[model samples]
Target: MADLKGKSRATTTPADGCALCSLPLLVPQEPSSDIEDDEDEETPSHLIDDVELPCGDHFHWDCLMNASKISPVDKLRFCLFCRQQAVTIADDGSEKLLVHVRNEGGLTSNFDLGEEIRSEIAFDSNPHLRRTEAFLSLMSQDDLETAEEMLRGEDGAEPVDPNSTYEEGGLTALHVAAYNNNVRAIELLLRYGAQKDKRSNDGASPLDCASQVEAWNAVQVLNS
Candidate 1:
């Protein structure tokens, strides 16, 4: 990430401001004198190419790319605010935030993040999605006891149906659990009436979802 040591010169900032430097979305007024230019140095306009992630937050391209580099894993990088896969539109309307990966052979290639980690990127407006997300979170954390209680409508709260679909994708609790490789959570949901063969709106079964993310443990459990 470019060292944002100087204050932003712009008077107005985007409401969805850049998360990394916390400065105005505009390019830095001038490149830091300390930064030596190289053959690959990007122009100011290119450097300031801001992007809005799937989570609805904006960030500078360089800053987001720098943050993504921290993850050594080969999987798609997610937004810091929400753990959903990070995707955005380029100025030309093409998919931005392509993940460039290097293999053991030292070859590099870019790939678009077409994978969907969470159907609901931001659930602030939808109470149903928020509640369902909470249940999914508990499942990911392996808090089976609380998850069961929520399913049973304990404490006067409306019971969360284990098989109920959520958000635009119509993903069931089992789909989420399987995608996250939470074997224990899968077993818990199955015990509480979650359908093992339930499919998402995209027609992906729990096993298919698990395999998409290479969640081997979840795949084994679902296959059995």
Candidate 2:
């Protein structure tokens, strides 16, 4: 982990507002002519160390660090605004904020944190399958764009199997969407090749799942 104790003063400020506090960045003063050459060679001074987020916005370094301290471990120091991973794991498994310019590509890469969560759930050895259950929960709660992204794997990562079943009740993404009366999610899943007649572990089809939740619109769509 990067040291968080340093208290260097910021010399330059960002024109755009801080991503965290939304306050204007502190501007640095012009170099003084009377300063000695040795003093000029000393560590540079700044009003705030503007750290760029994965979403391309910037935040004060201290603000970023404070956010990281309160975020969940699974999120892995994600951006407060965009929810993109803002930290990287070192070779020794230590987590550190990717603050250097060379590490910027990791922020801009096509990797999807949501896909990472899915993979982790699929590979988990625990019999309870809590992660898988959470993945299904997300399917019901996520917005249209997020639902489509997970189904289509728009981040260029391996697409999650649309037919993959939840270990608890063998419910697929389509079944969850139907139960929630999510018409757009249903459309996206159908377009992505989800089987309309596929049965769950309880022998319930997507229509059955919809009916259980009183999703009449989903039933009509499935009936068609």
Q: Write the per-residue lDDT of candidate 1 for residues 1-224, one digit (tens) a residue.
A: 21222222322234655777787665545566797877796645412335455565666655655554454323335676566776556788755455432211221223343322222223423566667777877776778898888888884678887887766698887898888898888888888888887888989999999999999999998888
- Write the residue-wise lDDT of candidate 2 on 139-171 in tens digits: 767665665675566745556567778767888
Candidate 1 residues lying further than 4 Å off, grouped into runs, are 1-133, 140-142
* Stretches of candidate 2 exceeding 4 Å from the true structure: 1-137
Q: After superposition, how far is residue 39 of candidate 2 from its true place, in Å?
A: 34
lDDT of every predicted structure (CA atoms): 0.64, 0.63
**Candidate 2 pairs with clashing backbones:** 9-46, 10-46, 10-47, 10-48, 11-28, 11-46, 11-47
TM-score of candidate 2 on Cα atoms, chains taken together: 0.41
| Model 1 weakest 10-residue run by lDDT | 100-109
TM-score: model 1 vs. ground truth: 0.41
Error of 1 at 44 (Å): 40
